[model samples]
Target: MTNEEFLSKMQDVLQTEEELKLDTVLDDLAEWDSLSVMATMAFLDKDFGVKTTMKDYKNVKTIGDIAQKAGL
Candidate 1:
């Protein structure tokens, strides 16, 4: 998917009105929580056929990190 589409989808996954960018820090978002992590795992699996576990998120710091995992 295009970067714009990924960002848009992330907005929904994060359940936030704040604009997301590749450089956006996940920890700074109010909606970035355990629930959002599950949503993101589902999003990646459903949309990108990528499998992920909680351990995978340990090193993830930015929105761009997730994008990379999705191969976007």
Candidate 2:
């Protein structure tokens, strides 16, 4: 997937349209909580067949990490 597609999917998963600035920190997002993490894990698995764990998330500092995992 392309970066735009990844960002769009992230917006859909988070249920937010707040502009996805590349430099934005994931933790700064109001929706970035454990639940959101779980949702993201599911989203990745369902969409990209990439299984991610909470432990794996510790290394994911930004939305870009997620895009990279999705192979964008």
- Alpha-carbon local distance difference test for all models: 0.96, 0.83
lDDT of 1 by residue, 13-36 (tens): 989999999999999998989999
Model 2 ranges with Cα > 4 A deviation: none
TM-score leader? 1
Q: Write down the worst ten-residue block by lDDT for model 2.
A: 15-24
lDDT of 1 at 38: 95
- Model 1 residue 56 distance off true place after TM-score fit, in angstroms: 0.6
User: Tens digit of lDDT per residue, candidate 2, span 1-72?
Assistant: 777777877888887768775566898888888888899999999999999999999988899888878776
The prediction achieving the highest lDDT against the true structure is: 1
Per-prediction count of colliding residue pairs? Answer: 0, 0
- Identify the runs in model 1 with alpha carbons over 4 angstroms from their true place: none
Question: What would the TM-scores of all predictions be?
Answer: 0.98, 0.87
